[model samples]
Every structure is written in structure tokens, then in C-alpha cells.
Target: MPAHIGRPVINLGAHRVDTDALIEHIRTTYSDPDEHPRMGVWERIIRNAGVTQRYWTRPLAEATATTGVARRAETAFGDALDLAETAARRALDDAGLDPGDIDGIITSHTTSWTVPNLDVHLVERLGLRPTVARMPLTTLACAGGAHALVRALYFAQARPGARILVVVAETLSTIYHQAETTPQSMIYRALFGDSAGAVIVTGVTDENADGLGPGLLADDPFELVLPGSRDRYWGTIDDDGLHFESTRAAARAAADSLPYLTDWIGNRAVEWVVAHPGGPRIIDDVVAGVGLDPEKHGRHSHASLAENGNLGGAAVLDVLRRMHDDPPVSGDPGVLAAFGPGFNLAAIYGCWA
Candidate 1:
């Protein structure tokens, strides 16, 4: 092994739309008085979220439209390839490594499908080594990104001197409900957007290793099981679009658990919190649960909320990218957390180096 364990994320790149354009797009496309009221509820919620921009895989119509099976299939397949390739290459470039140097690939996307999956497609398009190992995660929702990263770390631990490329491309926009108005459905619609991110991790490190930084803080992974919360947020294909349900109780459970986890990790206030930017209410509830100044975490939370809405598995990374780009200081500590299908929360603490 060269030097370090889990390499620190050194650079991040993303593409997104500003808040004003996103709000206008949502109002013009999805919300209607009959189906959705002009009470300015969503607008007010988003504005309070503190996000100024977000990104997606397609226009809002494509998300909730009733299209022929053949057309939907075609769109999903093609878009999956485009998203995977774009994100993978960007991460490779940021790490200053040629794609061929990626000894392994871990791809994560929950909202769509591809025949060979993005790993094989990326191997072919980017001309990676023919023997590059492939690991693809299609489920697990928002937790997929961190899961993939941790898996990469595990692989490195198994065999020293290996390099793994981890990529997450969850297109939440591809799964949408335009006409649903229940609290669950409304929360789902209000939260999700589409985006992708990738990171390069080397098993071995060096003082001069490109795109590599400090070691990862250690922590055991835990999943909080909230019984009967299975249906709190579930997605299914329908004529109107992909339908989602986000229950009030589920949101409360996620909020309630934050404090316990925070305290377990050794303190109440962290230098940074990378909580998933699910929606205004979810963030608000989590803020109250953690009892920290929302103003501190509010900017990244609201910024990710406003800009990308919620990018499912990619949401936490979107926030992390913001922190990586404009970090607070060299020794600041952070907690990266997100809630997912198990109605569970996942967290890892880190130091900025």
C-alpha cells in the first residue's frame, strides 16, 4: 500500500439550474389549481429551504407524463447511459486519472435501468481496462451513494494498492407524480430532482497522489428500522409517471432519530452536517431534532433543496460537493447523514483535511 486508507475527496464538479428557473419550471409544468393550489405553499417552503439551484435528468413533463411503453423504455435506457458516462468521466478528470486507470467501478442509480448497467457501458465508452471489476447498486434509494463509497473502501481494504471509481446518478425527475395531492405524494413531488456525482478513491495513498487527501474517520454503520414505515416512501411506475409516497410519520421518525445518533457520535454541534436535502419540512424537522443553528447547515440544505430539489441518492453528495469546494477550514469535523427506504438513517463523521 502506498500510504493512506480511504482517500479524501479533493475535487467536485456538478451541473444544476438556478432556483428561479427551477421554480418557474415546476409551476408551469406540474402544479395546477385543480390538482395543486396556488397557495404559494411550495414556493414559500422552497424559499425557506435556502437552496438557490438544482438539477435533473429531464424536463418535469417527462417525469410525470403517460407515455407509450416503447417510448418510456427507450428514454430510460438512453438517458441512463448518458448520465452514467457523463458523471464517470467528470470524476475521472477531476481526479486527474485516465479512465483506464480505474481498476474497479461502482455505479449507483435507483430511478431507471439500462440493459448492461452503467458499469459495462462505461467500460466500453470510456475504454477502461477490460478486466475492471463492476459493482452496480439499483436500489437502496438515497443511501446508495454512501453505501457505494463505503463498499469501495472495503474493496481497497481487501486488496491494497487498488483504485475504485464510485459514481451515483439518480434521476428522481424520471419518476414523478403530476396529479397526486395527498400529503405523501405532495411531499414526494416537492422533494425529488435528478442529478449525478462521482468520486475517485485509491486504496493506497501518497503525498503526491493526485485527487487524494486525508484518511476517512472511522465509524460503524447502523440502520434504524422504523416498523410499518415501508410504505412511507415507495415508488412505482404508473400512467401519470412514477408515483412516490413520503409519509408524515416517516419524516418525523427520521427527524427524531437524528439527535440520538448525534449524541452517540460524541456531540450535539458538528462543524458541518451533510443531511439529505429532501425538502423544506424534512430539513426543518431534522434541524429541530438536532437542535443546531439551522442557519449553519441551512445554506447547504436550502441550496441543495432549491437548486436540485432532491436528487434521491445523489443529494448528500451534492451538499458534500458544496462543502468540499468552499470548506470552512482544514480541521473542521462533519457528519454526513441521509434517511432512506428502511425509514432509516445512515451517518459517517469526517474531518476536513
Candidate 2:
């Protein structure tokens, strides 16, 4: 039996920051007398980041304040919980199921560190059964959303009637630092937003599962961790908070992983390509690498990035939501892919129902 993915719901932070404004803010906060020579270069890079606007839980002023890690973590934890709960409720509603019906829950997040992880918090707030199975995932970074779904699919398959809730939330804005002058850190401020996304997955035999949504075929779900590519994209924690390490190689990693993805996809007719919009460059690279017709399928990924910035693991789900809103013809096969730290590539094959 296959696992079906119900409608996905997304919740973004309250404040939307324009890219130009963000660039100016970065210039004021991160610019140094010694780095004056490179300020022009930094401006060019920020303008080309492919984000026109991004949403945040707090305004730029609040985020850039001289706050300690404890304060930032507190803000992140609260914001994450609010967004995660909201997205989860919306997803459950779309699936036409109740919280009590959820037999298992899987959560993926990386923007903050906390005890009692999100799954535990959600189970309590959502009124799910205490006995419900729970899995909380971290460290997958931007790939966490798709990876969570992949894991949920497996759970659904094992427990025939299980209805699983998969939630991914990231409050990346909380990690922004004025002290970190690295180019990657500066770009991160302009490229990422706070957002949460949730979806419900159920086995074919699950109650009220008469094909309510797209089916995740049990045949092929693929994951690849590129050898020695860890440095392409990663994060480090210190007294200042989480600092991101990103190289130009991060954008090209998707193209590099394409051969492996193609091999995993085999001869399947992939009519729609739902890819994580890592950035404009990454999106273009993946389209070219996968042989996709830009006019036909490229907009799906671009729209997400242009509108939502990078929501980390929540990004793939945002793209999925867009695809669902304007669906393809029934029986059309599709591929979903996302890349994150570990230079990992996670993908799943599905068909429109």
C-alpha cells in the first residue's frame, strides 16, 4: 500500500522585509572600515541573492538587537511553536482528520536548540494522544522537510492505518548576527526567513483515506550524502549563536547530485519537477542538470523562492503547496528533491492522483 500526502499548510513570520531594506541593514550592521573596499562586492552579491522579500517573526530592529543566546532561543522557541501548531492544524483540517486520529508525528527543525523538542511540544498543544509515536529530527538543515516526509512515509507503510503528521519549522532569523562579517553570514540575513510547514500522510488502508491527495509511491524514495562535501553548507554554534558556512559550491551541489538522482528515478516519466528553491542559482542549475524545460517546470521552484525566501526544510513543502494549488493532470509522475547540510540530497517520486 502506498502512503498519500494530504494538503500541506504553511505559516510564515509576521513581518515581511524587503530585500533592499535588508541589504541596507546588513551594510549598516556588518560593514567595517577595513572591509570598505569589499562593500561594493557585498552589495552586488546581496542584490543577486534572488530574494525580493522575506518574512520574519520579529522585525529587523528586534532581531539585530544586542540580545544574548538565551533571549534569542526563547524567541525562537515561542515563534516556532506558534507557527508549527498553526500549520499542523491547517494540515489536519485539509486532510479532514482530527488530532486524535494522528497515530504518529514527525518534526524537523534546525533554527534553534531546545529540550522537549518540537514533537513533544506539539503533541501536548495539539491534544494528540499521549501514546502517539514521535520522532524529532534535527541537523538535516534545509533538507529536513522532505526528509521528514520520507520518514513519515515509512511509518505509514509499517502501520497500515496510521495517519502521520509531518511538521517542519525554522526561525532562521533568530540566528542573524551583526558581529559575524563573513560573506555567507551577510547573505544569510538577506536570504532566509522564518516559516513553518506541515503535511499529513496516511497509508492506503487508513480510515478516511479514499485518495484524498497525492500518493507517495512506495517504490522509490532516495537520499544521497555527497562524500567530503560537508563544507559546502553547514553551521557552527558559539557564544554568538548559530553561524552559517556557505560556499558557492552549495548552489552547484544540486547539479553534482543529479546523476545519482537520475539513476534512482530510473526510467520513470517525471512530468512535474518540485525542487527545493535553494536560491536562484541552485534552481537554475538543477533545472539544467535534470534536463527540465525551464518554461514549463522552472516557475514552480522560482515562485517559492521569490515569494518566501528560503524557509530551510520548510521550503520543499512550500513548493509542494504551490504544486497542489495548481495541480497537474491526474496520473502525471513528479519528483521532489531538496538539498541541505552534509551536502545531502533527499528525493521522492510520486504521481498526481
Candidate 3:
């Protein structure tokens, strides 16, 4: 097989809004301990998401030249772009590569949308090569980080020595609606957090210079199908903001999808499992579905949830960052996975360089 030719993870940069202050504000704002027991439940639920903090653009008031919480929805599109650019630049610096070296750029976000989109603005502001290819993925949910990585890997494989940037920005804070108590809305309130994680991957022949090993994708890999369950999750643009739908069936869907996932990991000694920390219940179902030890990734996943809440598309990247900064018990060959809309699950193989 030909060498895949690029380092999987040369470096990573993560930025977040002030977490402690945000937590305090949330606790203060939702001060009715009696009226909102769920609020208290969430204060505890957030601790398990494997995030310590997140970076966000200004609140809706600041993002928009307006007053009141309802007006904040209007500014979400703009703030997402602001956060993405800031994180992407930091990632380029982390990789010690100039923006001009970037031959491809992939941006992942689920919270907001813009007319020209983030890619166009980033290209101009970062001084990227004029010919740089851009891929913007939206509405993919938590699996987006892994999805972006897969896209970058393919680009590097086709163009040997090419550099690609993957930027994941999400602002769940901007989408929160206090009036709605739908299951989906409650899930968002319980899980979502604001954050961005960026990484630069470059095709490199030398193994030592690469901080991580290249991901060797096996040709003709088996596809594990979840049968595309719409019963799990859905989202749409509404007059006020995008409204999402999540069913109790989602947990059942995750549970039912496990055997197929386990078949994919058959016989592989997964040294580390990097999964998006959706929540304790959702993650537990994922672990059970994949037939893996819940204890293996429990600590990291819990830490992310506890500290960061849920960062939507950025959650898995946050997990990767924690692993990169404080690796899980050192070794080789870690299995990374994430779930997204369309009720999709993506897995990848990575090793320490």
C-alpha cells in the first residue's frame, strides 16, 4: 500500500469562552431552584462532557446591535465566523506552518450560518494560497470533528506534501431558547457548550518530524450501517432560530446500532477511545453498542461533560485535545469515534508517533 503521506495530528489549538464565569452566569440566571430542577440536574450533567472550558464570541447582545435574548438568534451567524477564524489562525501557528502552506481548509459548525460562510473570510484574513480548496460542513452534529479530519486526510493522500487545516467552531450558547421545553431543546440546554478546536495536518515523508503517525486507511473497508434512523435526531430553520428534534428513540437507536459497530472493531486492541462526550446516558449507549468497556473512556468523557457541557461538533476535537495534551496512559493505536446527525457514527485509527 502507498504511504498515506501525512501526519494525522501535528498540533492542536483549542479556545473557549470563560467557563467558570459562564457557569456562574447560568446558575444565576436560572436561579429558580424550585421551578427548574432540570437546571440543577444540568449543573451536574455538564461535568461529564470532558471539557474544562470553551471560547465563544460575545453574547447575543454583543454579537448583535440589539437588546433582549430573543434578538440574539439574529447574531449567531456572524459570531460563528468570528470564532472559527480566531481558532484556525491559532492552529496554523501551533503546526508551525504559515497560512500560505494550507492547500485545503475544512470548517465544521452546527450552530450558525453565514452568507459568504467562514471559509471565504478565513482565506482572505489568513492570507491563504489563492488556490486553496475549501470544504464547509454544517449540521453534522458532534461527529463533525472526525468528519473534518477524514476530509483533510483524503486531500493529503491525493496531493502528497500538501497541508490542510481543520477548524471546528460551535456556539450552542447563541442558540439557547428559554421558552421552549421540547425534548430537543432540553437536550441542548443540558449538553451544548461553546468552543472551537483547530488542527493542521501536513503530508510528511519523515515520521519523526510528525508529532503523530499518519492514518493508514485500509482500502475497501467495511461500511457499518446504522440504517439511517430519522427517529434519532433532526433539525430545521425556524422563524426564530433553528429548532432541533430529538426523540427518546435516540437512546434506543444507539443501543440497537451497537453490534454493527462492534463488528468494525473486531479483534483490535483499542488502546484509547476518543469519543464525543454527548452525555452520560448517550455515551453509555454508544459504549454498549460498540461492546467496549465503559470504564476505558469514562474518565475523559466525564471530564469533558463536567467542564465543557456539550460543544456540538467541537466535542470530539476537545477530547482529542485533552488526549494530545495529557495522553491516556501512552502507547500506540487509539480508536477515535464520534456520532452525528443522520444518526451517523464515524471511527478512525490513530497511533502515537
Candidate 4:
């Protein structure tokens, strides 16, 4: 049975910050003349990051304040769990299903260091039955959203009549550490936002489903890892908090590994695409690598980045939500893909229903 993805719901942070203002604030924080040299470069990078505004779980002053890992984890987890619950409720309501209807739950959360993950917390908070199956992805990073949905598809296919709830929440603002001055860290300061997104997946196509809202009929889920590409993207933790690190190869990793995606999409006229808003480079590569028009097919992905910054695992979900504004014709073939720290790629092909 083909899995159908219902409309996704997204929740962003309370604190919204414009890119320009954020750049200026960052400069003021690092007042030393020597720091100015590096801050100067980051300012240019921020200007070109293709982001207008982003949300943070905490206030700018508090978020940018250096802190211990234990405190960061306590706050980040509280924020993520709160955000995920809201998104999950909205998603269930959108699907016209009660919490009891979901038989399986899949969640991806890497921004916070939490012992009991989102899946367990959601089941308890949402009043789901204890027997409900759970799958939590803690290390997928930015790719976690699409990664969770791909797993949801598998669950729906494996169990007939199963309805899976997919949720991803990130408090990316917690990674803003004043101590880290690397270029990659600087770009990250401009590149990420805090968000949570959720959607319901059921094992039924348009032909079989009765009251499902406008969404995609999912199929052909795929995942890949470039051999010896571990260095492309990785994360580390320290006294200040989490840090996102990347190398030059990370810039080209998407383009390098997209051939496998294009291969699987062979001979199919993929009419639309929802690529991860990792940054401008990843979006551009998805356009060229997949042979799609940036103006038409890639516009929503760009819009997500411009408006929300990169919402980590929530990016693909946010992009999918935006597609409804300029929806494709029913049955139009499309692809959704996300890349994260492993230089890992998770993709799912579908058609508007």
C-alpha cells in the first residue's frame, strides 16, 4: 500500500531576528579589533546567506550568552518538547484524527541532548496508547525531518491500516556559541532557525483514502551516504554548547551524491522538488543536479530559507507546507530531499493527490 502524507504543521520560535540586525548584534558582541577582522567576513557571509529573518527559542541576548552544556540541554529540551507537542496536535487536527488514531510515532530531534526522546514524550503527552510503536532519530541532524517521514512510509507500508505520526523539532539557536569563531560556525549563526513540524502518514492512496486533505501520495523513498565523506559535515559539543562544523567538501557534497537520486528518478518526469534549505549552495545544487528550473520548482525551498532561515530537520516539512500556496497539478511527479551531518541524503518521491 502506498503511504499518503497529509498536510504538515510547523511551529517556530517566539523570538524573531532579522539577518541584518543579527549581524550587527554579533559584531557588537565581539568588540575587539582582532575579532572585527573575522566579524567583517561573517557580515559579508550573512549578507549573502540568502536569509531575511529567523526565529530563536530564547531571546537573542540570552541565546548568544555563553553557557554550560547541562544548562543548554535543560533549556533546549524543554523548548523542543513544547514545540513538538504543539505541531503534533495541529497535525492530528488537520488530519481529522484523534491521538488514539495514531498507531505508530516517528520523531527526529538532534538539537538537544535529552535522555527520553520526543517519541516517548509525545505518546505520553498526546494521550496515545502505550502499545503505540515508536522510533526516534537522535543523530540525523538537518536530514531528520525527511528521514523520519521516510521511516513513517516504511511503517505504513509494513502494517496495513497503520497511521504514523511524524514529528521533528529543533532548537538550533542553542548552538550559537560566542567562543566558536570558525567560518562554518559564523555561517551557521546566519543559517539556522528553531522550529518543529509534524504530519500524519497513512497507508492509503488517493484512490482508497476518503477524506484526506490535499497532500502527496508517497513512494520511492531512498537514502544514501557518500563513501569517505564523513568529514563533509559533523557536530561537536563543548562547555559553551553544540557546534556545527563543516569542510569545503560539504559545499559540494549534495551535488556529488545527487546522481544516485537522479538515477532512481530516471525516466520519470519529476515536475516539482522540495530540497532542504541547508543554505543557498545546497538549494542551487539541487536545482542543477536534478535538472529543474530554479524559478518554478525550487522557489518554495528558497522562500522557506528566506523567511525561516534553515529550520534544520523541519526545513523539508516547512517547504512542503509552502508548496500548497502554488500547488502542482494533481498527479504531478515530485521529489523531496534533505541532507545532514553524515553528508547523509534522505529523499522521497511522490505526486500531488
Ranking by TM-score: 4, 2, 1, 3
Question: What is candidate 4's lDDT per residue for 1-353, written digit by digit as tens?
Answer: 67888778999999998987898898898889878878778888887888999999898999888679989988998999999999999999887889999999999999878778888899999999899999999999899999998999999888866899999999999988887778888789898999999998888844558766678888779999877889999999887778888898888899988888999889888888989998888898897678888777788888999999999999999999988767899989889999998889999998998
lDDT for model 2: 0.84
* Per-residue lDDT over 1-353 for candidate 1, one digit per residue giving the tens place of the 0 to 100 score: 33222322211123445556556755776555663575377666545545565455565544457674456655655665676678777777766789778788887776664567767777889889999999987776787766776677677657666778877766665554445445455345556666666777666545334545644332333345556668666656654444555566665767667666767677534666667777776676665555556767657766777756777777777777776656657666656677777676666655555
Question: TM-scores across all candidates?
Answer: 0.80, 0.95, 0.79, 0.97
TM-score of 1: 0.80
Better of 1 and 2 by TM-score: 2
Per-residue accuracy of model 3 over 1-353 as CA lDDT, tens digit each? 11132222212123344445544655665568564666655555444444456444565224223234345544665566666777777776656778887889988777765556667777888889889999988767677877877776667667766677888777676555555544456456546666676777665445534453433322112223378687687776665666567787776655666676667778766566666687777666665555567776555666777667767777777767666666645345556667776787766665544
- Across 268-324, the per-residue lDDT of candidate 2 in tens digits comes to 788887788888877776666666875568787888888889899999889888887
Candidate 4 structure, TM-score to reference: 0.97
lDDT on C-alpha atoms for all candidate structures: 0.63, 0.84, 0.62, 0.89
Q: Give the range where candidate 2 is weakest over 10 consecutive residues by summed lDDT.
A: 211-220
State in Å the error of residue 18, model 3: 10
